[model samples]
Target: MPHAEVDGVRIAYLDEGEGDPILLIHGFASNKQVNWQYPGWVDLLVKDGRRVIALDNRGHGESEKFHDPEAYGAPLMAEDARNLLDYLEIPQADVMGYSMGARIAAFLTLNHPDRVRRAIFSGLGYGMVAGVGDPEPIAVALETDRIQDIRDRTGRAFRAFADQTGSDRQALAACMRSSRQKISEDDVGRIERPVLVAVGTEDEIAGSPHKLADLIPHAEVLEIPGRDHMVAVGDKVHKQGVLAFLNNIDA
Candidate 1:
């Protein structure tokens, strides 16, 4: 139940284990539990002598909810992450984000490379640039209202969202709808630290994991065949890939 006050809101974070630090970021409409809990990522990283920080982004989990469209952008999300580290007195740490979290992690590396020692971004199923072009009008139509419509459209597939305790699903859906801001390819190119992008072979939303790796200079890509997004986070093969990446960084 630890919380960090950032941007006039309280952000929730789990600080566990000890040693070199690694922060885990979750995806859209997903809380830290939904995204990282099932994966055993916290235990996996801690077992490897790394402290894990699993954070609940604003509008998700126990964190504050901001319905303002501007509050949901990558810049705001990324800033919230750094702010938490600041509060915790953490100088620098490795960061790993999945799906939407990956997007913010990528931005964090680009914007504050000094704060992140290394990065592992998964569900790179699709590059941000590619996903930006996807149809958003459907989501935009329900930004301020149309709650049921948003749910009706994405509810089944993103059931974890529907299961949100209170304002989570609404706030998360608003965040997605507000992603009308243009993606900066340059920000992606500015990743100076070692990077790892991964995806399960079955991910459809983030399409072409290999292409994502190709775009990020010197980054490595690993595709876990036969595993979908959730499985990639929870499956043995995917966890091994993560450990391998972390080992390379420490090496």
Candidate 2:
């Protein structure tokens, strides 16, 4: 485990293999290992000769945690990614992010276009612009001690996931409060890097992948058949589609 101090926060990360780098950003309540390593993403990409870099976002995993809502946002976290790249002395790398990580990646690509060669936004779609539902219930669920008391389906799921990951509920509640700033359609259209917007066919939370792809000038879509938001992270078709996208010469 390596640590990089950026924007006054210490972010834990794993940097492995050796080749062209691909930075991996995990979803909410997910650490690098849970989202990328356990899902075989690191192995798959590494075997394909890509140097993999996966980071624990500030409030999750072994990274620094903040209890104040003002301390978190996709743009701020995007800077953490950018500064980590600077710390590693890499000018730019292909970036991939899931769920909340996808939002962070979009901000990174938009704010620092020259620092990203290509990007993959998975587990998120039109939700990036239209919004991903209200965060209040999820944040409240995380703050509640008894899981059985959480009535909102999405909130309960997130609460369970936070507990399973041994996350700081208070910090995560704060993160849930502020990390989900939606990107404007105009801003999304400004991303010049080659981009892939991937989501599961059955995913109810991601809105529509096609709708999002339509907003970006250089974006493509991948629909992981028979998978939903949770299971789609490690789908074989999703992996294959990503590999094909990365290896495409004209992309």
Candidate 3:
């Protein structure tokens, strides 16, 4: 559980294994362990002979918490990821991100292409450009006194997840309010690195994997069968597809 002071926030991360590097970014309300370690992503990638680095984004996990909405945004958060790479002295690495993490990874790739060799967007697809619904309800739910009072289904689910993770609900609420900045279709199309857009077949929140893949010049799509947003992260199909996608890249 090493921590790096990037910009002004303290980002907590896990660095393991010892080959080519890959950086993992987690979703909203999730820490590095809950998103990558517990899900076997770190072990899977490490066993494949990769150096795995996963970070807890600002206001999540052990990272420094910021209650201000302005303190969070995909582009701003992407800076944290880039700074973490600089902190670790990794010139470039393959990057994978799930849900909110996917957005952060896209920004990292677009804003600092030199620092990312390949990119994987999981649990999010066309939603990257078309918008992933509204975050207001989710924010309200996180700030609500109790989950039982939440009426919106998506909001309730996010609130429940925040509670389950023992996250700082207020900080998460602020994050939800501002972190989802949609990337333009034009911007996504500009990414020159090889990309994989993987989303669950049943994921209503991720939009269409094909639609997103169609945007990136070198992008491909992987649809995790019989899985939805929440359960798709650790799915066998997802793990296999990602491994294959990573290995297929020529050194």
Candidate 4:
């Protein structure tokens, strides 16, 4: 429930545990607790001697909300993470993000490689290369009076999830309107640090983890078998794979 002022907005974040730092960025419509805490990520990582830092992207959770579409983008959100790191006086730390947060993590690594050590991108696959899908339907769904009014299945699911999270509908609609920036193949290739691309085998939203792994210079893929996008976040395999990845890295 801690807050940090970044770019004129008060961003809510949770800084917990001890030892080496790991910044956790949650997916769209999810906050630090729902995405990382409820899933036992904080406990698992903390048990492994890691300091966990997670934040609610603008327009979600306890953070300040904005109705302007221009206020939300991968770059701007990534900057919020960077500014949070600055606020904490963390010069460098391991970065991990899920779904939308993964895209934002990529931009953070690309723009401020000096501030990142290893990168973990979860709930993302070839979509990072294929481009973020259309935001119009999702935006419209968020604005609708009822989830049943959303014709698109994905849009309905997102809208319902946002509602369950008690998110600001207008802010989320604006976020959907402006969060379409995609990372290019060239940009992926430019990342020099070790990267882990983790995705569920049944996640249609995430294209292919292998496809994305092939693009990064030093990257590997971890597939959570028999899980989809929604269910994969709390998978035990994901937690183990990440712990092993972190353990194997030379500190």
lDDT (10s digit) by residue, model 2, range 49-129: 989999999999999999999999999999999999998998999999999999999999999999999999999999999
Candidate 1 overall Cα lDDT vs. reference? 0.75
**Ranked candidates (lDDT, high to low):** 3, 2, 4, 1
State TM-scores per candidate: 0.88, 0.98, 0.99, 0.98
Candidate 4 residue lDDT tens string, 1-251 = 88999879999999989999999999988999999999999999889898899999999999999999999999999999999999999999999999999999999999999999999999999899897578898899999997877899889999989988999999999998988688889988999999999999999897799999999989999999999999899999999999889999954
Better of 1 and 4 by TM-score: 4
Point out the higher-scoring one by TM-score: 1 or 3: 3
TM-score of 1: 0.88
Question: For model 3, what is the C-alpha lDDT against the true structure?
Answer: 0.95
For residues 156-198, could you state the per-residue lDDT of candidate 3 as single tens digits? Answer: 9999999999999999999999988998999999999999999
Clash number for candidate 3 = 0
CA lDDT, every model vs. true structure: 0.75, 0.94, 0.95, 0.93
Model 1 residue 1 lDDT? 69
Best by lDDT: 3
Clash count per candidate: 3, 0, 0, 0
Query: Which one is best on TM-score?
Result: 3
What's the true lDDT of residue 93 in model 1?
A: 94
Q: Is candidate 3 or candidate 4 better by lDDT?
A: 3
Give RMSD (Å) of candidate 2 vs. truth: 1.0
RMSD of each: 2.9, 1.0, 0.7, 0.9
